[model samples]
Target: MARSINQVAVFGLGKVGELVAILLADAGFKVVGLDAVPRTMLTADGVELETRPLDVTDAAAFRDSLRGVDAVVCCLPFHLNVMIAEAAYDAGVHYFDLTEDVPTTNRVMELSAAQPAAGRTRPTFAPQCGLAPGLIGIVGASLAKQFDEIRSIELKVGALPQNPTGLLGYAVNWSAEGVVNEYLNDCEVLRSGRRQMVPAMTEKERVLIGGIELEAALTSGGLGTMCETYEGRVARLDYKTLRYPGHFRQMHFLFEEMRLRDRRDEVGRMLVDAKPPVNDDIVYLHAAVEGIKAGEPFRENFVRAYLPLEIGGRLWRAISWTTAASAVAVVELVADGRLPGAGFVKQEDIALADLLDTHAGRLFGHTTITQSERA
Candidate 1:
């Protein structure tokens, strides 16, 4: 039998964390929002959130915070997730996060695959619940299922200002650490039915959405476990980060020529300082799968441009709301027993239709363009 989830504890009260807590509370769950520093109870969009300070580094205090919680949603940095996940495992509560860090996810997988004591119900460890690794993987996998034999799966995502400025043509609407990590870490991909690790920011290619030109290149952690899941079954599978033209060239010069690769924190700070968060931002998603449908070649594309909108009487950025909504929708599914109560949950394992059906998932609507073609 599946365990019921009612009360949820959300760690990290940053931009994304606060909204996740509010959205969960709005979904009828008892929510406890925690952060390293003190936070006032939030009453927004008709939802009253209970928030408090919590130093997660303190082991006893961290465990104590989970005492009456049925589940935990971690919106903290990637490096901090393994610690929170380990604690959640010990506490026997469901765990979820929005980490795109490879090592962090591997640690979560180990915890989920561990053998629980006799009669102990293993908690669910669902990571990569945000937009790129989360929704993009879901969309790619959903499209792949329609084919008898999949030849390739291509995914690209960009969260950028609707209007561009400067050479970078970007804004720091997300975690600077995350963006830097993706740009620096090695990317896992499936090429010619074999899994391989490739350097990030390579494999540059041109991409067009709604007649707007963009460039894409391999990025770390965007594929999540899709390469492993689709290995030997699919001929090609890769994920990339979408950026405006000439963006990658500038990135190469900054990290390569300027030698800022090892100093990730400094680079992140510099990037954020230059390009802070923007209110008028757009989240572009392009997922394409090519394969045999009914013994004939076919291609399906799920492309959309997500924009900021009013939610709960306030406006939220495209990146913020999309990440928050996707994470909250997965939480809602687990709370309603729509997903497994125990064990590891991969983003690709989720059905796109079911995800869209959730209260928060409805925000992913308004597809700018969807295409089906013959290859």
Candidate 2:
């Protein structure tokens, strides 16, 4: 059995990283928050936290900080995650992150599969532990298991203002780079038992949730490893991002016609400067699976909405809370042996019920499962 994790080193002090440190500390783990820039003392729910100043890009400094730490949770930018992940592997500590970049995740998977040093235990590497790629994949995989002959699996997730007032009908509650990347990259899917890539924002469809009309379209990284996990078993599997009506058309213009997709950095800056983050945000989650169960075709829908939560006496946006909570929950599960301690761990490998039952995951509220008539 793997030794329990008692001390954690969290790299990066961004919004999600801050909350991750706080939540882990609140959960009674010894947490050390690391960042390149100096930061003021942090307190979550009135409990003070221990923070360190260190540069993750510096190999010696990064590996030194991981000394005596059981695990390292990375909240750094998707592009910069590989450095810290490499440091964690060298230090022989378990690693986790909320990255959605395909190339970054692939690199981490490679690191996870590599052989460890002499007599050292191999550590686990779990990535994309946030929102769409995190909880959505967990729920989708769980639902897919209920069927004997899987047909289609659809996933849609969004973080939007409760009362959208912008031209795009959205707010930048999360990383601007992430939004632009998902919007511009090709999405992975399984069509007719074959894995394929489709253009993002091409399959626009209107969906209604709780009486509000929303739009969903193909998006990258949201599917995590589900396409590969269910490739041959499920006939059709795809993931889409939900937005308010007309948002897709506007994005299509900026990315396709205006050629912003070619200039992602400028586009990211524009979004950060324009769509300011909102506190009163809602996270919409929807997962549906269709397959033959007990000789009858069945369809199951798992839907839930998350709002801003008051944690540790602070009001956290729905996106921040949900994303941080998912990462924290996975860390706890790893610490307790509920998950693998070595090698690459995919989001779909986690069971939905196990995730929801965790203390941190309870913020999303209970999942509602509905069954549709036979197709």
List the candidates' TM-scores in order.
0.96, 0.95
Residue 220 displacement (Å), model 1? 0.3
Model 1, position 315, has a per-residue lDDT of: 89
Choose the strongest candidate by lDDT.
1
Q: Provide the global lDDT of candidate 1 against the true structure.
A: 0.90
Residue-level lDDT of model 1, residues 1-375, one tens digit each, is: 443889999999888998888888777788999998777655456656788788887888888999999899999988899999988888888999999998999999999999876666788889999987899999999999999999999999999999999999999989999999999999999999999999999999999888989999999999999999999999999999999999999999999999989999999999999999889999999999998999998888888888887777888888888999999999988877888988999999999999999988987875455555445
lDDT of 2 by residue, 1-375 (tens): 543789999999887899999888877688999998767645566766888899766777778898899999999888889988988888789999998888988899999989998877899899899987888999888988888888899999988999999779988888898899999899999999999999998789998888889999998999888888888888899999999999989988998889777899999889878888888889888888898888898888877787888887788888888899999999888888899978899999999788877777776673332323234
Residue 197 alpha-carbon offset, candidate 2, angstroms: 1.0
Worst 10 residues of 2 by lDDT: 366-375
Candidate 2 clash figure, as a count: 1
Name model 2 segments beyond 4 Å from true. 1-3, 40-45, 366-375
